[model samples]
Target: MQDTYLHHNHQEKHLKSSELLTDIVIGMSDGLTVPFALAAGLSGAVSNTSLIVVAGIAEIAAGSIAMGLGGYLAGKTEQDHYNSELKIEYDEIETKTEVEKEEVRIFFREWGFSKELQDKAVEEICKDKDRWVEFMMKHELGLDKPDPKRASKSAFNIGLSYVMGGLIPLSPYFFVANSEDALKVSVGVTLICLFVFGYFKSKMTGVNPVIGGLKVMMIGAAAAAAAFAIAKVIDGK
Candidate 1:
């Protein structure tokens, strides 16, 4: 029993890490792609490396804010939804005691509990209204209570990841004097980073790392290429 409890704790920690990884992936994928594309586009249109660098910085700042706010709002929505459901569960347990008890019995029935054991479980569980409602929420509604701090944590993680990812592509622009030359270096660096990032991200989630890596690399390349093409056409006009 002690070993089982420890294993369950480990599983919970792993689940939280998985959630964090997902948020990082969300932020980093867009972070690498958008700034890289913007820089490529700007490099195509302008001869000034300074202008491209400045614009890339501005876009990263704005994009991080937008993405962080989106993550915060999503987390807040989940919390609110859980709270609303919890309240409803409590009310039902209070006002419809017999119906709630029957629901508990039905749950035990579905679990394949023996008739005598089901009666014993229901009798034991229903003695405490709080415990009864808690069980119903978990077993019936399939909702876990979300961490109250999840919204702020998600916002911080996503925003920080975006800043880190965005800096990679933009860093090359700072080093080179010419925008076109900087773009060439940035493309080489960013595509490699994208492949590596995607490979590990997929590997963590049990995907084929090679395929995922290539897919992500191609996507970054395509986005940059399209943006560069559009800017070149506009510049030619």
Candidate 2:
């Protein structure tokens, strides 16, 4: 039992780490891409690095807030959906006790429990209303209780990640006086980061890291190139 508990705990911790990594990937991918594209577009049209820097910063701020809010909403939605299902489970257990009991027995039966053991397990489990409903929720409905702080935590993680990723391409503008020069440096830096970020993200999610990295780099490069080309065309007019 002690070893089982330890193993479960380890699994839970691993799941949380995976969730955090997913959030980072969500924020960082957009952060690096959007600002890099914006700077590239502006660099083609404008001569002043300061303007690009200001625009990039503004974009980062807005993107972070937007992404954070999106994460928060998604977390809240998960919590709300779980709570609603939990209430339904409780109601079913209360108003339809016999049916609920049979369902529990059926679940155990499917799990390879013998007839006598299923009866004994259902009786013991049904003795506690809370435990019974929780079991049903897990087994029948297949929903887990969402962490109460999931929303706030997701918001913070995504927002912070967006800021960090957005800064990479923008940093060059702050150092260089010319937009074109800053863009050249930004392209190199952001491309490298996109590749590295994608490699690790893929590895974490059990994908081909090298292929993932190259794909991400190509996508970012393509986006920036297209944005720059369009901006140059517009500026030429």
Candidate 3:
């Protein structure tokens, strides 16, 4: 029994990792695509090295804050929903203890429990309020309590990943920012990064990474083209 319990807990640790991995892919993908788009657009508009540097800096700062806030809000919203559901469950158990007991018995019945055994299980589990609530949440609502700290950490991870991803496209511009040469380099780097990022996400999600990557690459290219076209028209005046 000790070995089984230990193994179960050990397995749970691995499951928790899935959440962070998902956050990483999402964060890094944002970091790469967005800044790349911004850099490409600005690079087209002006060939000034100082201007590019300023734009890159601005994007890094603004984008990080924006991504972080978005992630934080999303996590908080999910947490709030879970808390509300939990409250409702608690209230149900509080006001209708007998009804809750019957529900638990029925649930275990489906698991092939005899009425005698089910009764004992229900009685023992309901003895603790915390344990009872947690059990109901898992069995009935299929949810868990949201940890504010975990959510906040996930948000931070996402933002940090975006910054890391965004750096890929921005790096080349500084090294070759003197002439229009840098813009092309940035575009080249951005497309490659987009494909790699897409592949990683696809692998995780079981999607076609090649197609996903190409689609992402096309989006970047289109954004850059539109920006360049606009700049050309503006310059014509």
Candidate 4:
């Protein structure tokens, strides 16, 4: 029993860590791509590194806030949906006990429980209303109770990740005097970062890391290239 409890706790912790990783990926991917493309575009149209730096900084600030708020809202929505389903589950168990019990029996039946075992299991589980409600919430609704602080944590994590990623492409502009030079360095740095980020992300999610890395690097490269081309054409006109 103690071993089982410890294993369950480990699984729960892993799930939470996975959620955090997902938020970082969402923020960082956009942070790297958008700023890199913006810098590349401006480099094609302008000669001043200072202008690109200022615009990049402003974009990073705005992007972080927007992404953070999106994470917060998504977390809140998940929590709200879980709570609403939980309430309904409790109500059903209270007002429709027999139906609820039958549902539990069906689950046991699906698990290949004997009729005698199903009866015993249902009785044991339903003895505690809270436990019964929790079981139903997990099996019937497939929702684990979300952490109360998930929204704020997600916001902080995503926002911080965004800032960190956005700075990578923008950092060259701080030291390079010319926008074109800055853009060249920025492209190299950002593409490498994107490949490395994608490699680890894919490994964590059980994918082919090399292919994933190349895919991510190509996406950032393509975005920057498109922006640069468009800016060049527009500036030439």
Candidate 5:
């Protein structure tokens, strides 16, 4: 019994960790791609590295704030939805007691409980209002109460990850003198980072790591290429 409880606890921790990883991937992927593409595009139009670095920094700042706010809103929505459902469940348990009891019995019955066993289980479950509401929330609605701190945590995590990822591609522009030369280095560095990021992301999510890596690398490269092409064409006019 103790072993089973410990195993369940471990699974919960793993799931929470995975959620955090997902936030990082979201922020990091966009952070790397956007700044890299912007730098590439500017390089095609302008010769100065300073301008590209300034633009890249500005984009990173704006992008991180937007992404963090988005994460926060999403987290808040999840919590709000859960709370709404929980309130409904509580109200139903009070106003439609027999109906709720029957629902609980049906669950036990489906679990292969004998008639007497089902009665016993249902009685045990519905004895306390709080426990009964919790049971209904978990078994019927399939919602675990979200952490109250999830919104703020997600915001911080995603914003920090974005800043970190954005800096990688922009770092070359800071050190290199020419925009074109800096872009070359940024391309090499950012694409490598994209592939490595995708590889680990896929591995965690149980996908093919090599293919995922290539896919992410290609996407970043294509975006940068397209942006550079557009800038060059416009500059020529």
Candidate 6:
């Protein structure tokens, strides 16, 4: 119990920053993809500057609100799911102590403990309710406490990023009053942003930043390109 408490305290102090970065990448990627594609497609189809501006603005507003609400709801749902899982977890630990202890023994064995040591480790871990639940939550069920505020903020960031991403590609057309040039500018902006986002994501996930950025750029460019091409075909028909 004392050793486990010390380990937990140390782990808490060394809480990895990797999780936060991963969340940011997820938010950024989500923000960069859809709206840009949609805007590009619409711009190509309607070429009327006024219509493009109107549609683009509407998409940004709707997407932002939807994203924020969805984020809030999802965070709440996660908390609910964890609460439900905790009950099951408690029941399992309470009713099946010996079985759970052996289960944990096998788990520790896999992590490079000798058979005797693993049994001892499992005994130590399962002796306490908190340790037992923590182990099960981490290894067996893969659950964690949900932070509602963080989730909501993450969602808002995603939505804001998406709106910004969407507007980048469309703003040029409206201000420049030339659909083709605007498309070019919008696409250019989007690709750059995607590349930057990719690099950051890669860094967070421990991947190559350059490759990540390139991947993001390619996807954004491809989606926008495909949309424009599709719109062109539709208009021709």
Quick one: best TM-score, which candidate?
Answer: 4
Worst 10 residues of 2 by lDDT: 10-19
Candidate 3 lDDT, 1-237, residue by residue in tens: 999999778843222337678778778877877777677667656778668777877888888888888888888888988889888889989999999888888899999999899999999999998899899998988887777776688778888888888788788877874636887887887888887777766655666878887877787778767876777677772
Q: Which stretches of candidate 6 lie over 4 Å from their true place?
A: 1-20, 112-120, 148-150
Candidate 1 matches the true fold with a TM-score of: 0.91
**TM-score (C-alpha, index-matched) for candidate 4:** 0.92
Tens-digit per-residue lDDT, 1-237, candidate 1: 999999778843242345688789999999999999999999889989999988999999999999999999999999999999999998998899899999999999999999999999999999988888889989999988898999988898898889889999999989899999999999999999999998988777667998999999999999999999999999993
TM-score of 5: 0.91
> Candidate 4 at residue 48, lDDT?
95
What would the per-residue lDDT of candidate 5 be over residues 1-237, giving only the tens digit for each residue?
Answer: 999999778843242346688789999999999999999999999999999988999999999999999999999999999999999999999999999999999999999999999999999998999999999999998999899999999998999899999999999999999999999999999999999999988777767999999999999999999999999999993
Instruction: Give a tens-digit lDDT track for model 6, residues 14-129.
Output: 32564345444554565567667777887777767777788777877887777767766776788789878888888988898778887888888889999889978887887889
What's the distance in Å from true for residue 121, model 6?
3.4
What pairs collide in candidate 3? Answer: 31-162, 31-165, 31-166, 32-165
User: What lDDT does the true structure give each of the candidates?
Assistant: 0.91, 0.92, 0.79, 0.93, 0.93, 0.75
lDDT of 4 by residue, 23-124 (tens): 899999999999999999999999999999999999999999999999999999999999999899999998999999999999999999999999999999
Which consecutive 10 residues in model 4 have the weakest lDDT in total? 10-19
Instruction: Tell me how many clashing residue pairs each candidate has.
Output: 0, 0, 4, 0, 0, 1
TM-score per candidate: 0.91, 0.90, 0.81, 0.92, 0.91, 0.77
